[model samples]
Target: MHELVSWGRVRLLGEAGVQAGNDATTPAVKITVLGSGYVGLVAAAGFADAGHQVQCIDIDVARVEKLRRGEVPFFEPGLREVMSRAIRGGRLTFGTEINAGHRASEVYFIAVGTPPLADGSADVSAVYAAAKTIREVAEAPAVVGIKSTVPVGTCDAVQAIVDEGARVPLRVASIPEFLKEGTALADFMKPDRIILGVADGEAERVLRDLYRPLQLSSERILVMDRCSSELSKYAANAMLASRISFMNELSRLCDAIGADIHAIRRAVGSDRRIGPQFLYAGPGFGGSCFPKDVSALAYQARQAGVPLEVVEAAGRANEAQRVYVRDRALSMLGGEVAGKVVAVWGVAFKAETDDVRETPALPLIRALVEKGAEVHIHDPEAADNFVRSYGLPVRCFENEYEAATGADLLVVMTEWRHLRNPDFPRLRTLMRTPNLFDARNIWTTFELGKSGFRYLGVGTRST
Candidate 1:
């Protein structure tokens, strides 16, 4: 068993004035990141920006070409700028495959996607394929770090694959990412903690060296066994998801008892143990990480004969929350929305991200359409993505008021910065009916009621 170690203040050879992404003292290392998805692309860009020569590899020819021209395929704050700078500086490159010329990397990061399967277990086939490719192309000894969130024993299985047909010794380490979508660049630059699951000293040393620049103030690297590191990622996401689900469950109670969730959340979050984070009750917890990771953790536990009841309950509650939001909207529309014009503001799961993988707005919009309601939607960044992903009959507009024009009800699903404060007077004039459903609870009931609009918020008294 590898001992869990926490190093304090790593003393590097040249560690003076180490700024994130601009550390000159850190020696540049050649890195080959497999996969160009969210996690992979972010890792590739972050490493290159941190004074490392990075080559991001992906199977998609179109995506690779787009990345070559410095066109990021997704919306992430500050990602395009960082990637552009690295590309211009000749430190970052993109490729479709691993070749003989790309064999000099001392560290190889497998940042492929391990999407959840039907049984709620993660499908690590992409991860295994990346490992196989790295094993085939590794001419010198290299550390293969798994940045993909995976099962507990996935690293061991990958290690076995690398050891099968290896020209040189290859080490497998679990370096699971804990990045959030909107704040990915900042998260990478100043992570709360970096988990390094390594069996050998070489893997740990190389990964530590690569991540040393980011730990200038204090050491935030947590070194542990591979299984523990892999499990930690799932556990962290599960905990956050549980908090949101718990609050959502309470939101229903608040609605029933006419209690304000904002007041309750403030009182509950004031406790030192439960700081204000993920405590707000919204439509539901919908994102790539929380839902999938929670379900995957529960599934893995059940397979091991130890089911995580709390985690399982969190997933069920999330599903229930989506239904509750849809049902509440229907209730507000008098249970018969056959020809009502409903304008939905904010289709993305959260602000600043175009990812609609499991956005809460999806179910609500689908339910509205099924109920014969004409849904018009608007999002600053995610409108196009939402339209492409679901292809619903809803009309998508560039402007929020345009979506709300001639609408009976305006439902605010996402809490984008611009959607927080709207021209209520203009909204009332534009809409056929002055009904507003503040699903995100961004608007105050008193203000909306004073604006001569009927308003309903999550876990707040309806006006």
Candidate 2:
């Protein structure tokens, strides 16, 4: 965790009486969020739930219609319920554009996507478009908060766009989001730190008022410049990704030297300086944030005549880790996977969400299919998304046991809650070869050899 301290124009909340700008006594501010994607929708619903009137805008007409009918396009654990409740309270609404109805909004959040381009730079076209839209539709002096994860100086660039031909004073600020996919709503409602990247005191005050509800129990706000705020999101994600890649590299060393990576991890994480978090050694780190952010940061660094070697290496290590899992599975099967029945237990990168953007399972499954292996997959929530996105030639099973039936090998990818424990006896009876490749190390606690099965786990002694 980054230290919450006062440094170089960065101040903690309440320092120098800054908390007086916004407090519990102030009424909830009207908010309009541009883009109804994961971050946008969650922010809209969370702000509404906090008693603020919020209007979520999107360019996708069909998605807007669905949201208007209380339908969420994606699968987040508690978002639908919160959104539904907010809609019922009349505090949350959805639309395709920022029309006259949203003119009274005091804060506008640009929550659009900043997808990676071919060279790994963030494609902030959506963010720019949202700024132009705000400039055209916004009626009053509103604080334009950026909730999108963008490269450094993006907020400044957006400021230039919004400042042109603007009828009102639209202040652009970087309020980048750090919400995780599985626990986005909780992360939003109780954020670790609310970053306020503002150029002027008015922008800070208005955003502080907008986010005042989340800061009831304690002060969790960090005030800084827009560039630093934009860079902080990428820097945080890159550091976490580097930790995961470092653990993965250690896991491979453990595999080669007949040592337990878990034991080493326990000792390493015991140190107070390195508290245990993001230290789990799995197939590899994957998702929308880590990989993209690391790559984008590296790209941005290179553009500035500097290079982030650690961030670059982290990206390479993740790809190598995925290949390592794939190669290990094939080598265990006597270096031949052709015509073998392989069951993949989990498809999502991690648990509790249906997002599979850069899941390690993608490359592994693709390699399996390319090697002529019959791949069967089962995930509690991500099967449909995996199928629709990859279009891989694999059997999708509704049940984990069903997916394992008649399988020569079972490879566990994501650490879904239910996948942690399984009927070993039933699996032994169902599998043709009874070989279990625990890529996630979720079954390391169980002695599978006693169940008459050959078990192989990452960084664990093969049985």
Candidate 3:
């Protein structure tokens, strides 16, 4: 974990009159972040580390108290250390409700969750609730920046809510968060670009000043209309998901032809137009962002009378890819998963985060269980979260080796670095049957066949 900002450095800067904008001339501003989830807590801590006073508010009182003591409920690397340092620096605080202190702040950021509804549209009730709270408590004019992932025109809707019999002028801006999980802190501290969707100049200036510390290296802030900014968040995630789905679709063809998708990826990704990122073939794309964003975008497109067929197809492919993997794993067990012990190596959507919102492992495990396979799941960081997400009857193991013990087949889902180089010989010895299913293609070069194990990799030829 690179130390983005330390307590001593921030305290000394505060003493020397240094502020958030990276310009000593500007004064420090007070910031209040709503909903101490991944995005909110990270933004609050990053702001406080930049010498600004931040108060993070969450409706969950127990969660707030846990954060106040520097305990992060979820797994995020380097966040607890920075959050603790910010709290000790007297610049970061947490509370259950928005009080007068937050009302007096210069900026209030709503980073609440916009969970997907049954129809795939984002349920913006939390966003509206946060706006209402800010409206009721705010005594002074403040820029109400929305860091939540909401549908387009959400900022306008929030502005209307704040404008309804308001005592203070609230400038609504759609500052949708672009922080990725597992590296959220670093992404916040050193962002690629800060998208500020503002209706007016005041909202723009307020957000720009708040993020100026991160922009010292380059002018990475992109200012646009609120509607465009709101759509940009969904568009970005959908584009990434499209790339992933496209690759997964091609991977199926590669497997059918006995051609390696790895080489195909290199051949195609080198085209400069098609980048290498998100090109890796895996079970499917999942997490809190990709699935929900894709679904919401498709939903919004339908509502607007301009259906996004490509985006919807990508989502379908993603769902099908999960089923394909599950079916492939069952086929490896002689067309019957009943009375089989199956071990899953990684459960998180990807690696490095405990978020299991739409992890492929869940559906695969569920299908295996339904087929009467005894499932054992293991993940370095996401075991607890997976267990919570999946209240189903399955064995949760502390280590990968333990999970693989006595298993008829082992499946790799997330590509954790630690899963890259496992003791193949030991794994072969531990399993009841030496069957290795490399879903992420992490062990393609391991030559498991030489170790007396049958290896099956996605889009790779088994030796």
Off by over 4 Å in 1: 1-25
Candidate 3 differs from the real structure by a C-alpha RMSD in angstroms, to one decimal, of 5.3
The TM-scores, one per candidate, come to: 0.94, 0.94, 0.95
lDDT tens digits by residue: candidate 3, 1-463: 1111211112224443224344554456678999899899999988988878888999998998788778998999999988888888777889988766556777899999999999999999999999999988877678899998999989989999988866778889888788999999989988888899887776677777777777778999999999999999999999999999999999898889888899999999999998788899989988888899999999999999999999999999999899888777777798768999999999999898998989989888998888899999989889888888778788889899999999999999999999999998899889999998999999998777888998888778875
Q: Give RMSD to native, each candidate.
A: 4.2, 6.2, 5.3
Give the lowest summed-lDDT range of ten residues in model 2: 1-10
Error of 2 at 38 (Å): 1.8
Q: Which stretches of candidate 2 lie over 4 Å from their true place?
A: 1-24
lDDT of 1 by residue, 240-333 (tens): 9999999999999999998999999999999998898889999998878888899899999999999999999999999999999988877778
Query: Candidate 1 at 343: error in angstroms?
Result: 0.7
- On a 0 to 1 TM-score scale, where does candidate 2 land against the true structure? 0.94
Greater lDDT among 1 and 3 belongs to 1
The model with the greater lDDT, 2 or 3, is 2
